[model samples]
Target: MLIVTPVTPVTPTKTNFEFEIMNQNIVKALAGIMEKPGTTKRDTLAISRRVTRYICQQRRHLLTERHALRRKARKLRQYLPFTALAVADLEQQASDHNAELLEAYRRVLAAYGRSIIHDEEGIAAALGFDQLAALLNINPVHHEQAKREGGETLQGLVFVARMEDSASGFADEWGAGGPLFEACMAGLADFIRTCPDHLLPDPFAPGEVFGPKLPPQLRMV
Candidate 1:
């Protein structure tokens, strides 16, 4: 009679390893902009700060969830032989979350870039941001004719009114209250109007070749 030896199976690693790497890279990129003055568009510093704050907040929450998932996956692995399958399921969830977070980060960046261009052009002052408080009450319908024209006429007025309402408290943080400031305002308005409301970019939250592609040219600015 011959003695038989037992076979050892290979253990699988965490399925979300790639997503974790991607998440780290995004963090590093955003942080890099903060550390180096000229890494990103100069006019975007204020908006960048706001975007970073939101991202950091999200990353903190995601980190907690990732840690908790890791612990649970480990515990399950020790107790079950089929742990690989379970871990994969958990990682799938993590992947979905990572995808959403990454998309939001990308959207914010694109929107901000467009805003920088508008600020340089002084579009916000032309919209009469200083008099926004007085114009907020006007029914948006009066501007409907202009809005239909899609010539940026109504969009400008609407942007000023919306910013006055949404980003009411961030005057100083928006920039030196100049074109850069108004650019920040218009950029945020453009993102809000174009992106699905559900994405909820910047909570505070351009033009042709200078803007992102979308209907209502200026609306997507």
Candidate 2:
């Protein structure tokens, strides 16, 4: 027989890490929910109707929260246009299936969860490698129109989230961010803290970072 001591699991220091993972799960679950209805399977129209009301209600609540945050000088959510963007994507999806209403609501939810993702290759070229790699890891790159050129141009909008860095005395300002958005700052900090060397953006090795800055022949967007 052997005596054993209990070992404690390390708590995730960064909150957004958990937040993003949860949100991804939510997205997957929503897809499943929409595809199959309860009791009597929701016909496409019925599902569309249900989702529409759900989004409208969520939008109102979000608007209220935005107002309160603005009033209190807290960081206002900059995702108002997000829903609009999703609307555009969902419209395409709807057009594919001819589900007008369903597309609209899908757009709303999609925008509800839009963010950017960029590696440090460019930012390192401008700022430095260390800072770029420090950004939080969130969403993937958005492929609207595959660019034939200018690889450095960011195809993602990384969420420039609020940082809890005591040393970073910056205010929580919300709005558009540069193309160099790599990840949520909170996650970035965690990445740097835990895995400083095992990440991307090894700019000193350019070929490894962004593939030798694409040839001039490719027309970039």
Candidate 3:
């Protein structure tokens, strides 16, 4: 009697590339918030909240889809004798889908980071943040590192912005309404009003550094 052995599919694991992709996505998202259409503090805050909510919604949807695919693949694998090929195919699809989602996320983060670094630097400088930082002895080494490495520094800014916009009264406690804050708001408003074109550059533009490298079917619509 000849016996056939069932082949076990290798479990999908995250690679360094996936981590890099996620990091890029986060930076681009922060840049997006800074580039939103808002001049005054109120307007900028509102726009940032809305955009952040939208990004969260999209991420949740992608996660749900990926989870469902993975679950289905696992179920299919149980019927190994009959479903080996199908299970493997399903696993591959799930992996590809995840990669696509990561790529989409990365594009957003890179775009947002570039917008802040290239488009909004002038606004920050004009608002006297540079001088204020100098006076407060705040080292901008993290900011410089974010510009160079596109890492967690950008994500940290997003967290700060969220906290500032929260209703916990933290902003008030931190003197968020001070002269420097007002100047920052006013400068942002002026930048938005004057250079609307530069705020949200297309991250998926052809030949762009962060453009979509995935196939059309795999890319997020």
In order, the Cα lDDT scores of the candidates are: 0.46, 0.34, 0.45
Which has the higher lDDT value, candidate number 1 or candidate number 2?
1
Best TM-score goes to which candidate?
A: 3
For all predicted structures, in order, the TM-scores are 0.29, 0.20, 0.37
List runs of model 3 lying over 4 Å from the truth: 1-38, 98-102, 113-221
**Candidates ranked by lDDT, best first?**
1, 3, 2
Clash tally, candidates in order: 1, 7, 12
lDDT per residue as tens, model 3, 146-181: 233222221222222212223333344553422222
Candidate 3's TM-score: 0.37
Candidate 1 wrongly placed segments (more than 4 Å): 1-44, 106-221
True-structure lDDT of candidate 1? 0.46
Which parts of model 2 are misplaced by more than 4 Å? 1-30, 33-42, 73-106, 109-221
> How many clashing pairs does model 3 include?
12
